[model samples]
Target: MSQHPAVTFRSAAVVLALALGAATPAAADAAPRSRPGDAVRSALDELAGGGEFAGALAAVREPGGRGRDYTAGVGDLATRAKVPVNGQVRIASTTKTFTAAVVLQLAGEGKVELDAPVERYLPRLVRGNGHDGRLITVRQLLQHTSGLPDHSKAIPGTFFDNRHRYFEPRELVDLALTQQPLFPPGKGWSYSNTGYVLLGLLVQKVTGRPIGAEITDRIITPLGLGDTYWPNPGEQRIRGAHPRAYKSRTGEPGGEPVDVSEMDPSRGWAAGQLVSTPRDVNRFLGALLGGRLLKPAMLEQMKRTVPVPGAPRGWGYGLGLTKISLSCGGLAWGHSGDVGGYSTRGGVTEGGRSATVTATEKSLTAEGDKRLDRFLDTALCAGQRPAAGQALR
Candidate 1:
């Protein structure tokens, strides 16, 4: 299991959540000017202009109560327009944390039970191909221990092939049923998009409302994340002054960039389909870790970590969050995600430091993923002393 940082809450980080306290009016400012985080801005510039991505956006809050929004590269490859500061982008799997938070909140309210069998809520909906709802618990699904096959396999072709197709929640789950299980419930771990879809179903079953609305009422509005929102069903275009997401022609980093920002993200429902900005994402994360979103007991449950096999050393998965070791010191707890045309990575430290990066294209190679991790890690550890040779690029 990943180790939690020794630092606790009630620190400066909680200060951010107190005022809906981030993403200012200057968030639309043009690219970097002479100021703090020059290194962070330079790093983002290289990533976007170096042929790895068409554009990138970031929001970083330091330990001393200072924060800034940054943009790099072009927003639209066709126009060569500037990237919007703190632009909105599809947040992908990070939505898992929102879904998990609602489930945990429901569990806290006695409306749901963490250990209850999936069959208890949805009743046989999760049966087929060695998978059985009777044997899977709510906790298992939230934690990716349900042994369910990922429904992404059911998406037919590449993401571009069905950018406009809408998928029903049950239809996605049934698609996973056509596949085999990864392991018996609670016996192992694997990332399963299908499991979170079941969670969406459970939330609907228990609350009698759509999962998106639950997330909005329970989390977004409370945090005052004005730049964030759940995309309505069949919602294809991003709703604000955001950067255009790009797809690589060869499906690899450095390949020719193609615009693919408009997409119907039904395939990622309950697992990955929310739109948000770096500042909004940072604010939401800080609020979540600050006790505004869940009761203390439930937050603890969200912090419990389990080993993620094949993940980097010191990497672990919690209910819907990620606990990863930082370069400066200690650990950061947040999630990273990818969708059709965007990739985002960020984390809030135990001490209140946080940073988020949104690249307009996904990393198609392991090396590219590492570069993204390195840049975000560099941003979080900014203004701190550097190691012997690990200074920001």
Candidate 2:
């Protein structure tokens, strides 16, 4: 089985969790300036001007305790519904952060083992090619070191074709397992949605409950993040005011915007099914890293994984955690999530100063993703006091 405390994957880098701490309450200052907001807004403006992203709303906080909110462009093309700072767009892969939290909570309860082999619970999850499930561990799945290929077979068709339908967790897992392994377990790292699908399965196997229930009970309810939710088909839109989401095929190929209100939530499931606002995400991150979620030992154990070459640096996985650096002063621990129509990054600083930013456009191209990171880095690090000679940008 893959070794414990060694995170060799990008998605499940749990070691990054160490960067998070207590949740600082919303800043005491008067209405914050739009500088931080503009940092992100300007980036989205550039993207939209170039016909890359339709629009985005970003919320950022200062390490010294200030916060700003920004809304740019329209949420929908035809309707002209202005994007709101509290937009309830689908968080896509950002949901994995919550999933990871539930898994870690289970581990803390002694119901799950971080380094246990996957076959110990989900024996039926076969690792295609010459690999076996026994060779993979729970940590490997969370860390994306399970060597399983992404849900390629299940995507570009299943998800795209039936974009409005709900997919059972088993269906996605089955589709992913049909693919060949990318490498021997723990030999290297790759981002795999399949690993997270299996993790959802493990949650169900051990708890005998749905992934939604587990998250609600373990993370949501306890934290009292009432605004956060995993809405069903009949209940898609954000409860009150929210930014409407827009979708287009691309710039050159240019297609009319789609409302995206009726998109499928099941395809993402435990992996990326969440729809939350910056306030809620920030609060959750604060509580999670503020010593409220897991015991010290369990939290440290979950944080033992980090990033390596071919993968982003500063990544580690305990359960479903991701550790990222500020490149300014402190580090942050949380997940970076995405789906076809949305992209999200949210994490709290080592002192619980947290931020969450989300966009409706895919920005899937290597170039676009990189640009998005630049925007995120600028917005996230703008308020922090520089560490030593480090530059904010």
Candidate 3:
């Protein structure tokens, strides 16, 4: 068997902390629901109590920059520990937004051309499985229209079975090379971690620095996102106080939640390996939307979007960002992430309000995902006043 096989992470978004299924009744919160942000408080309680997750977290920032954090359920099942507000969780494919932002910054600097062929930097590296580096543009990789098959689809065994495996970026690319392309480059839209892996390689090639360092220097440090960091090679433990993440006892969804928090994340390099908190992620989103990360022209280019097949109605994807239509009207842009043992979902409004919802499990039932979406939507629109929603609950 191939060593350090792929692990499942929905590069687009996992179907969230709960899997798609029927909604079960969650317990009601004892806290008064009439106060400011009480809507989000109750939502977290439901997510923890009846959503079948071990814990949940959310951080809300208003248009004027005020922020509030909330948590529910236990951090440690064994100790019955309280969940830390704004605790760090594996932000999964949301890392794509960071990678894409850095690339856009490079594009703005003229160091990389968005329309240039991948061959320009990583020549011959993407050849195979009906794909050619010469024909695929750097844009296609970020946009996920390169027609590459996802290597994570082929990861073998349960998440626990490969907890300590270390994988190189090239190794991840090699795994995808063995599979057939989904279609000719740019002919369609598909989510492939393989494309992001190539993008990561391209970043390193052009910057003469590790992709992680590029992200840190260009994005993380500049924005003061102290809670975010790329894991060093072979590092597995989360660096700060965080709730233990859980996996089903049988290594499948819908069983007892087992502590599955610590594991090597090399398999998720570039595509889904960063650890961060809801507050930090929300800050990043607001700064990005406020045009702090990319020049106006490149930011516009990033927002120029195409339809995402199989996504909810009116959902569109821009470079690495996702544009979701809120029920209260207008758009909220951000990304969602799901790694085994943790799931995060939220978005930021163009007006600068944002919310991030996280769960401490790899599996969130279908109903749970929808509930979280409602919670996010409520937070985005409930009190903002500029749009159909309010500021933030």
Candidate 4:
């Protein structure tokens, strides 16, 4: 097997220090046991205290309920600025969920077939290294069972030295083609950014427009996600009031954190390049689960899950979304994203409650990851303590 690094963080923590100089009105006097957002704010406070994060934000909205926002720490460590309450963030691989939603919508419209061979649209682009385009289906691509290697790992120096370089979608796919397949198509499950890149190409082929435009027209604009956007090529910085992002020196333990807020996002392309805020993310997910994005059949198909053995327990891959069993005893649907200088996890419960939590630091230690997971679990569970012996999933 190839040694490609996993795109998501393997683990995360929330330090117990309160980094915000002043508490927000939404968080000041509420008890976590009484309010879900209060619980999330408490968790964020814990994470910011350990010095692992420069800043963090959490936003939650419940059905027929008032929305609440919470924040901890400073936006910039150098300047000691507060993080913007609803600032735009890179949002990394969460873009896949949006991409998959668009593709599934096309399937509903009869513009594309879910099980159709990718060769039908892209022709010979997927040919190479024991990979056959004729055998891989569009469903497999969105489900991440196409056996394709991640281009980020397949190509050396794609992220570090070329952080500012812009790449066409085809070029990114070509890099993955240079590596051997991880497994025959549909034989096993593996996360492949290249597979999603191909799906983006297929979307372009069918729609005659870039994936960004389709996502904007179908998902962003319709859902009223005003703060969400796909950055244009050569656009290297987040556009709104936002916290600075930091990456560990070489993304390893004990390395100095470096600011990486200005890298070009084209390197992530359709797979992971979209930028959004916690509130916007919650709104999108809420609308999705509320049946605003896809037709009934297509939405059900998106939730059809397969076991992800390499991921945390109770975690399953379904189209581009993740089905996670919460510690408080229920299923939550959403995705997690990690890229240079940022890490995010968010989800919506079946009853229409949504929450998103973000950290400014990219490279998280094991403890940090656990804390982040706990925050997600605690927030979604709606202030209900996890059942005894139950842990964050």
Provide the lDDT at 80 for model 2: 70
User: What is candidate 3's lDDT per residue for 123-193, written digit by digit as tens?
Assistant: 88988658799999999888878888888766777667877899899988898888888889889887787
lDDT of 1 by residue, 104-208 (tens): 999989999989999999988988778889999998898878888777766698767877899999999999999888788999877788888999999999999
For candidate 3, report its TM-score.
0.89
**Model 4, range 1-393, lDDT digits (tens) per residue?**
000112133421001100111122333332122244455667778877777778888777776534677778788978888888777888887788899999999999999899999999999989977989999999999888888888887556635687788888898899999999989988888778788889889999999999999999999999888889999889998988788999887777557878889998886788888999877888888889899889999999999988765555666778988877777776788887777877777788887777887788846765666666667777777556666666553
Best by lDDT, which number? 4
TM-score of each: 0.89, 0.82, 0.89, 0.90
Clashing residue pair totals per candidate (backbone < 3 A): 0, 16, 20, 13
Off by over 4 Å in 2: 1-50, 61-67, 127-131, 156-159, 233-240, 250-256, 311-318, 362-364, 385-393
lDDT of 2 at 60: 59
Q: 1-393, model 2: which lDDT tens digit per residue?
A: 011112222233222211111122344222233353444556546644545566666665554545566555567666777666556656666677678777888888899998899999998566555668888998888877878877644455543467676677777777776667778988877666677778888999999988888888888889887778877644545565565555554422356555565566776677777878766777677777777887887677666764544334444444566665555666667666555555555677677566676656633343445455555555555545556754312
| CA lDDT, every model vs. true structure | 0.74, 0.62, 0.74, 0.76
Q: Which wins on lDDT, candidate 1 or candidate 4?
A: 4
